[model samples]
Target: MSHRPIALEPAAVDVEVRGGIRPADVRHAKETVAALTRLAHEPVLRATVKLVASPHPGERRTAQAVLDVRGRLIHAQATAESTRKAVHLLNDRLRARLLKTTRDWENLRGRELRDGEPGRRHPAPPEEPLPHRPRREDPVIVRRKTYALERAIPDEAVFDMEQSDYDFHLFTEAATGQDSVVYRAGPRSRGDGYRLAQLDPRPGLLGPVRAALTVSPVPAPVLTEQEAVERLEFTGRPFVFYADAATGRGCVLYHRYDGHYGLITPTPA
Candidate 1:
């Protein structure tokens, strides 16, 4: 493959070559790095490209690019049949991620500015703690993972949740500091979107706790069952808990593990 002339501004970008990358491939990558100069200005748009040796002879190279676009990290990687093709794929993926993140960030900023305008006061509804009675039953503890609860807007959380490709994400509401979980409800074709369920830990339970538990009292977002189902599909999770806006009751939407969804709503006592 012919080596393209390097167009990347050396002072603004740093290139790291690793594994068994050939000199010619490294030269191609330097030219490809120039592509990112259009994404951001000099000095502010810094990027690191790591070229790794590909295991298969057909796919001769793997490229990983981590671009620091004004402090926010954007990562993309590609493995292709050729070094140049791999670099091209990496750049394409990186551009898509950067554009999506930029659009989401701008939309969030715009919403914040609008919410700050005067004469718009939407107070949260008053919430009373739900009754909780301790259950005495030995349960199996299979797995446990400690995670730091980050405070972010729902849009940002959704972005992270989608990127993580997890069933659910637990985060704190940036506006209220309320601990919340965003979970997938069902398939996206069914109009299911991500649903946020704020944790409202109920008191008045008396028992010897069998396991360590941390609960935070907070209010959940009120959405109808249909709305909850729509949000559930976005997270790609099996279940979600949401406050039913119609009945003013808490409900759970879960997958039956047989290609179906089960909606559990509070019954009148």
Candidate 2:
């Protein structure tokens, strides 16, 4: 059966500038993002650019953009001392990501023809940590997000994470029907900078994963939310993944760039 084509949204892009940004800089941001959208292989459904100038010291001017290309979302953000510099940096990052997404699509199609099976996209380039203020002495959970996790294979999960400009992604593993997370393993890691952690790992249960993945031999530690916070502080890792003691589900306690904590919990299926 043939499927209907998806309708594309209007070409108008949204630009929001806050904190006394000059009109010239604002126009530059809009034009740059509009130019980037023209490079997308898919329909540009929705696009938004936000520029913020903070009065606080060390909180540099920031530019962030989110583009909805058909059903996929591409995100990029950059900060600099000047608005123009931030916008330029943002453009460079967004352009790179857009190119990567296009490459991923072409690669997948080629592999399908050769292997006669679904193909995996290349891993995203390593991400640099976001600049932030000094760590607060008493950091509290400022953002709490609870959502139904996506069910996907490790390869697909990695693709989504990269497209969304996330350092890590949490999802339910389709192969073994277990909660899992795939994250950048850092430059010091052994393999292709990707690691997988599952709630209850089974050695041979997972099917073939195309992307180079290092599965954590140790199962997710069981801990309460408070305990997870302590672990995050003690370990000094970017994020801590653990099995929630009360829910028996995987949760992540992460350090936000704003010197606060963020909690991610999976909603019941």
Expressed as tens digits, the lDDT of each residue in 1-269 for candidate 2 is 63343322324768887787898888888888888887777778888988887645656787889988887788988777788988888888788787767656656522422333223333323333565434688988988999999988787887677666677999999889889999977642234557999999864888776666789989999999999989998888889999999999999999866678999999966
Candidate with maximal TM-score: 2
* Candidate 1 local distance difference test against the native: 0.53
Clashing pairs in 2: none
Report how far residue 183 has shifted in candidate 1, in Å.
Answer: 9.2
TM-score of 2: 0.78
lDDT digits (tens) for residues 1-269 of candidate 1? 63332234744566687566787777767667657645553233566777876333433456777766666666766666666777887677666665555545545433432334321122212211111111213212222233455767655565565443334566665765555666545443343555555645332331222111233345665787667756766665556667667755455665432234566554432
User: Weakest 10 consecutive residues, lDDT, candidate 2?
Assistant: 109-118
Q: Best lDDT goes to which candidate?
A: 2
- Give the number of colliding residue pairs in candidate 2: 0
